[model samples]
Target chain A: MKAATTSETAEREARRNRIRLMQGNEACAEGALAAGCRFFAGYPITPSSEIGEYLALHLPRVGGNFIQMEDEIASMAAIIGASLAGVKSMTATSGPGFSLKQENLGFACIAEIPCVVVNVMRGGPSTGLPTGPSQGDFMQARWGTHGDHPIVVLAPYSVREVFTETIRAFNLSESFRTPVILLMDEVLAHMREKVILPEPAECPAVDRLRPTGPPEAYLPYASDRDVSPLAPFGSGYRFHVTGLYHDETGFPTGSPAKIRQQMERLMGKMERGAGQIQRFELTGAVSGGSDPVDTLVVAYGSTARAAKHAVGEARQSKRSVALFRPVTLWPFPEAAIRQVSGSVRRVVVPEMSLGQLAGEVQKCIPPKAELRRVNRVDGIPIAPEEILDAIVA
Target chain B: MANRIEVRFSGSGGQGIILSGVILAEAAAIYDNKNAVQSQSYGPEARGGASKAEVIISDGDIDYPKATNIDILLALTQVACDKYTPDLKEGGVLIVDSQEVLAIPEGNFRAYSIPIFRLAQEKVGKRIVANIIALGALVGLTGVVSRKALEEAVLSRVPRGTEDLNLTALRAGFEEAERLQRAEA
Candidate 1:
């Protein structure tokens, strides 16, 4: 009886901690905490400002620091600095702010710093819709910063997924020693839903691997393992880090040999780990374990939810359709699409932006496979019925 | 199984519509052992915008928390009345604070044009408690939630010193509901 009572009490406490009605931004903050993020720096931008506000209120309570930086550039810079100091750090911004942070984001990539940047996307070329939704930043998130570099980006559709993916973003960042972008659209940012927050013990926490042996023996960039160990400042391991090409000892090396080596390692880590980082969900890919789906719907972010609904509606009308939702938008899930392309006869890409993910889908699928694009950019989510019409047509 | 009630509150941004829905949901979920969901919608501009909150209370789990048809529609403004009146289920109740919401629709649904603002002014000496008055009328008309449960929920939610005033406002609403019921009978 005592054992049963104790177990029941534990279960009740767990349920109490879990059930919550949380906004998307609040879920992102909670996810950051669950992922063991200890530092957050950000500037206030509409739709994304609540993330900073939430972190400011909640971070300190959990022994984490939240700083409101002067601008997005400084905010991104501060998070990179915090990451180098051996703390998981993150920053949240919208389009204009994301544009400002791009240079530093590239710097983090070149320097191989593990950090997460959340872009709660709003409508924009420049301040398009401060409060409305837009998925226009899909290409920007991939190639926003100048130069050739690989990135890992994830888009979440719901509040609960926001919590889970923000945690995944931090894990991927640390594991790969690069920045991960949590690309959230404005619809997901402001949407409120019931989310069950995981208990402190239930969350998986990843700390950056630390250097062992004497400080004198440490070579900051020297690594046989795919992931190099990160040495925090003030640990008596003196090392130099710069945006310029560098040697193994961390000194500036302009030599072509050193530059080639550094670039390969930067690119290779993501390439090598691409299999692990690529995430997609395929619904209704097969029927009766033999017949393949003739119609395919490709979507990401907020549009994916509506696309899923469309796929359901299409299936009821005797149309064999399936949905491909890209959970991880970057290190673009090319392999998954290639696999899906083999079976499906026609592909439909619906997005809030003008054919961003559609371009990527076309790149992966064969030319013979019919590809269609359904794009909307009026700051409203694409209705399922519209996609259903496209599939049937 | 006990009867379930879903209420939707609509008003301008600063009118405490979300807070009223939250209080009602908490009353049902925390106090009455019912499953409840509260959802609110507001545009990007936080102020001077149409805002709404939907509260769903059920003995079982609520599958779709979004109100397809509302049981009670509390419209604090003319725009809200025009926008939400059609969404109220047939025979559902409509409560409007007559001072802020000047217009009303004639319909089959039980429409209560409560002098919520005047009652709030007379009892609490402030118009802000008009929502509280409407909430009281809702409780009296439906009896979906017990008075004690709502009173306790309000006390826990409001700030320390303001509990007494809110309680008084709630009791006044309950009294008004009793008077209306007596008159009808």
Candidate 2:
């Protein structure tokens, strides 16, 4: 009887971790919930509507709030407001909506508000392809907001990574006190795959650092520390918030020294913590093997999946090729790229855009290395065969 | 079973083609202890536009999610059959709805033209469950996933009160597939 009971308990425990057939958008919502996101505000858009729809039905059940704002700008503003009120907040949108959120996104940056933004990329300059996939926003995510600001953008390749990357987006946002963008392409947003998610206990949630000093003595934008603690609005601690360049006291300042200090501290936080924020994966280059790969394939998002298949095919044909995929797209993983590309003379980058990511990779590799690009802008994904041809050619 | 099989279900948008692919992927990944990835391409129309959903099931990891060399092609309309027949591998399995896809294209593959929609309407008393019926025949024809797992996935996805109706439609397709198998033998 005792043995049977123990076996039954084990079976139930295993069942609790059952594999789920999850879509990428669905996994993002689950990740937000796991990261303790208690507020979501967004306008529904193509390739990203499911994330909003899922949260609309499930957020209230978990005692979280979900609001459908009138427009993308308001959606971004609402999340900023929620974050100021001591809640972990997020907003999800696609290409066009991402464009509309740029103004508020910059506001969040200048204000140093902690929030999450999910950009499910699709073909675009204006509302190009609603259901199609594209990575055209690769550079836009970094520089779209107009000024010099520190931002973190994470691009997940598969459904499993979508879950983990979304959680990491929240964690990095809170840790840096800056808005983080979870970049996902159309294919990654809509594709479904089997994922056994990590349990809550396994992936501990992270909250923003709180001010320990007296409420009256708090400085919202203190430059002395690497990251100044942010106290929620309406709390005992009162502080001013604005879009202008501010001093350590959280009020606007015209003094050049104060402006320089604030800007330096804002950019320095990321510079010192780049090691903890940047993530990349390297494969096909054996550590101890003598055959150094002469070709390096750089990719991210869904395109990386095709690149991975092509890399495996090349290896089977006795070709020396390696793959470098960046899980964190921003603060660009330059150090890892330089280290891996030192031995290779050829670097191939395949993306849905003409050459967004290729442009960035060009600045990092050896000056003598040849950069080859395989681009697809016809609203169709780059196939594995195309990548294989690039690898061998 | 082969190391990997790529299956594509092509039909009109409202015909539940994507949902059929989703159920098959869930059955294989959740119950059979395999890796499965499902993806789709659809136009902006909510209904009537040509839509295709593809599933890749493998014993190992699935790198590329889209189906290139299709092992199984299930077309519910003539337009879909004409469009996707060229993607099928030689000696691949092609299943189409006989009533809807009247002019079947020539292909280097095994073809099974079943009265899928008609059977759902006549035997199951509902035309909306044709996707479920088609799923049963596809599984019965290939044995790609276990029947128990298929039933479980179907029940979990369908509406609460419609389990009995959907099961009856599924069993009808299975019976028809069995008859075809016996005739070939």
Candidate 1 matches the true fold with a TM-score of 0.86
Which residue pairs collide in model 1, if any?
Answer: none
How many Å off is the CA of B162 in candidate 2? 0.3
RMSD of 1: 3.8
The TM-score of chain B in candidate 1 is: 0.94
Instruction: Quote model 2's iRMS.
Output: 0.5
Q: Model 2 Cα displacement at A166 (Å)?
A: 0.8
Across A1-393, the per-residue lDDT of candidate 1 in tens digits comes to: 999999999999879667765678889998998898989999999888989898899899989999999999999999999999988999999999999999999999888899999998888899788877789999999999999887999998877889989998998998888899999987678655555676666658767788987898888787455677889988888888888878777788989988888778778888899988988888876523475878888998778877887887788777889888899999998988887777667899999899888898998887888998898888666777778888998
Per-residue error (Å), model 1, residue B110 = 5.9
Model 1 residue B40 distance off true place after TM-score fit, in angstroms:
4.6
- In order, candidate lDDTs are 0.84, 0.92
Task: State how far residue A374 of model 2 sits from its true place (Å).
Answer: 1.0
- Interface root-mean-square deviation (Å) of every model: 4.3, 0.5
